[model samples]
Target: MPKVFGFAGYSGVGKTTLIEQLIPRLIHSGVRVSVIKHAHHDFDIDRPGKDSYRHREAGAHEVLITANRRWVLMHELNGEPEPSLEAQIQRLSPCDLVIVEGFKRSDIPKIEIWREANGKPMLYPEDKNIVAVACDVEIDCDGLPWLPLNNPDRIAQFILNTFVHD
Candidate 1:
């Protein structure tokens, strides 16, 4: 398996935005990046009337949809316990890096995104797995490195420097 790294933050802290901008930079550097984002509530990639949706609604446990450009596989948990992060990662095709957006409590190394406007409590203070902090305004990062949240190139470079050492 490729190395797994993550971004941990509260909702609305720009974790998604950061990752979206950072992915291309990593790819531009010739690194293939895969992302696994954890959602807190029920989410669906298929619409209600789609064939994939119909198959899943018809009690199919798995549905595979393919197009000329891409393919997707949807698996129904069917009341089973949610799989661990590692299990989900294992299902992804091989890549140079895995940028996880949630699974905050997992022990995988992560960069904590923070913003003063969010008013949410800081997570890195308690999360030993957090390797760095990316914040909007100046703050005392103490021992941890503080990355520029607005500058994705620098953030991408930092990620490459710290975690992409293959």
Candidate 2:
């Protein structure tokens, strides 16, 4: 099984930015990484009038678009219950690690991204699965492992040491 870790935080926090930085650094270090980001609202990769969009709109449950560079498979739930995180992870191709963004309530090891300016309470206090935190400002962590939000390399190293390496 691929090692899984997550980043969870309130909106306006720099979770995406941190992940973006970590991906390149991990890749450069020769680690195979894949990311799964959760969308809180409706999102569409296909544009209007495109054949894939038209097919989906016409009630196709799944659409596959293949090109020279890549391929995308879009599956429509059509009111079905959203798939569980475990189920979603099972569908991914093999990799060394899977970095999940969001799904805050899931029972997976996670690093909570925090920004004091967001005025949000710390999630680590409430979620036992939260193993560490990354923040822009030094805040009381209640003894949780902490990393600087500005240093993606160090953050990446922390992740690799904690989860990817034995």
Candidate 3:
């Protein structure tokens, strides 16, 4: 099983930006990483009336669209409850690490991105699962390691060092 860590924070707190930057660094560091992003609202990757969407809409439990270089899979479960985080991780192919962008309430380890401009409370100040914080403005970060929010390479390295070993 791969180690799972989440980049968690409120909206506009740079979670996506940090993950976008960290992923390539992790890849350069020779770590195979898979990402799972949790979306609150409904989303459609295959547009309406598209072949793939039509296939799925017509009761295909799993529809996979393959291109020369990549593939997209949409699995639909009707009345089957959402799988657990562990189960979801298992469905993905093996990787050195798994970086989840949301699912903040799960018990998995996480790095919280906090931007002062967002005016959100510190996730770690309460959530014990938050291992560290990446922040914009420096404050007394208590005992947790606080990294500058701008440098994704450093944060990426920290994540690999703390969670994954090569």
Residue-level lDDT of model 3, residues 1-166, one tens digit each, is 8888998899888888788888899999899999988888777788898999889889999998999999988998788987778888988998989999889899998988888877768788888999888888776678888888998877887887899963
Model 2 agreement with the true structure over 28-85: per-residue lDDT tens digits? 8888999999998999889999999999999999999999999999999999999999
Prediction 1 TM-score vs. true? 0.97
Candidate ranking under lDDT, highest first, comes to: 2, 1, 3
TM-scores for candidates 1 onward, in order:
0.97, 0.97, 0.95
Candidate 1 Cα errors over 4 Å, as ranges: none
What is residue 22's positional error in candidate 1, in angstroms?
A: 0.4
lDDT of all predictions: 0.92, 0.93, 0.86
Candidate with the larger TM-score of 1 and 3: 1
Residue 51 shift from truth in candidate 1, angstroms = 1.4
lDDT per residue as tens, model 1, 5-69: 99999999999999999999999998999999998999999899988899999999999998999
Per-residue lDDT for 131 in model 1? Answer: 87
